[model samples]
Target: MLRITDARTGDPVTATPARRGLTRVEARVERPDATGLRVLLTADVLVRALEIGGTPVWTVLTGTEDRAELRARARALGIRPFEDERDGGPGPGLGEAQVLRVCARTDEPAGGLCVEVAPADIENGVALDDGSATALRLALLARPRGTELRLDAADLADAEKQLKHWRGAVAGWATRPSGPIPDPVRDQLRAAWEDDLDVPAVLGVLRKVETSGTVPDGARFETYAYADRLLGLELTRDIGRGTPA
Candidate 1:
């Protein structure tokens, strides 16, 4: 019942298109019994390894004991065993394709867990550093609200469109009267114009101009002008507010 996600996209499985016609993927142990779990490549365990882009990439292994027993053995060996129910994956420099990895507590009695590290690639694509990618993917999933803001190709395009429209709206306001502007309108324009600016700064300005509890119609031009000057964007059609000297 333990759930795990990649540190980058906050998903259990993340695919990377590092090579054409081949797919790179990453997964982790939901929770380790100790601090780090050893990976195994058993027949049953790897059957569920999903394929992406027609390439089945995974290796499988088996462990000697259940989570608890493995942890004890790991501790006795001086290497901190993986934590229980904690997510883990291999480190970087490990190839990504055609390798099945299972995180389990080890029970090797000879003072060492039987280490099985086999690296391979799918479709001739280069392998990834399994350990680094897993750690990064896990870190990404741990943050709040971080999952919502991932910028993909479509998102970037959408933002670009919005920016264009916002710029046009500001241009329209710049040419017309300047009495009051709705806070929402000003906020949107400010956001669009500032592009990569922080949201708090814009919100602060909104609070300041909204003291009367009403959105000033002319605030559109005023706010646009203010933001343009503050953020250094071209307020091309500034009519009411004189161009900054």
Candidate 2:
């Protein structure tokens, strides 16, 4: 079972009814090796209240050391890191850093994505129904590509459909939920659903592309490369194929 805890207090903060505050959600998945499992966690702002004045909080992210550790961990599990494509074309920018941040904190299984939302990302005092919607959407646009794995075509298609459906459902629930949705997460999700260009469609096509056998097993890095190409194509189409600033 996945457990969430307050990173600072180490107390039970996740299960509590949604309250306006800074919190982290910790995900613990069973390890694949059976010898032991790997764990991963990320920090996100749980927008509990919209009307309160609070201190500015910052998320601490490490580089160099954690990156090396996570790379080794993924290798041990027979999973490869996404290839570094910044030298030429665009790739999952900052995604590696985010992944490393999450993996360094826990030992969990593979196949899940985690995101962090900081307090600075949240804009208080704005009505949720107003233009804050677009602000939130742009926030997701700014987020780096999450995972770059070679997925089975069928699996990719299924994940795409599931993501689309989840986006719609979550958007509707955001307006009024019998329960509560963290404000920060709610905004980011809604934005991704509304403005993210062709994420699902790109994944769907990638499924078919991978099955052509051009990318071999044990070559997961190539999967990232392919995903980047698909993303570039989609973005190009979105911006008339011109250079993306």
Point out where model 2 deviates above 4 Å.
Answer: 1-41, 45-55, 63-155, 166-245
- Determine which window of 10 residues in candidate 2 has minimal summed lDDT: 44-53
Best candidate, TM-score-wise? 1
What TM-score does each of the candidates earn? 0.25, 0.22
lDDT of 2 by residue, 165-200 (tens): 333332332233233323433343333222312244
By TM-score, how accurate is candidate 2?
0.22
- Give one digit per residue, the lDDT tens place, for model 1 in 48-106: 21221234443322333355654443333222222232233443224543222332222
Instruction: Assess each prediction's global lDDT (C-alpha) against the native.
Output: 0.33, 0.28
| TM-score result, candidate 1 | 0.25
Best by lDDT: 1
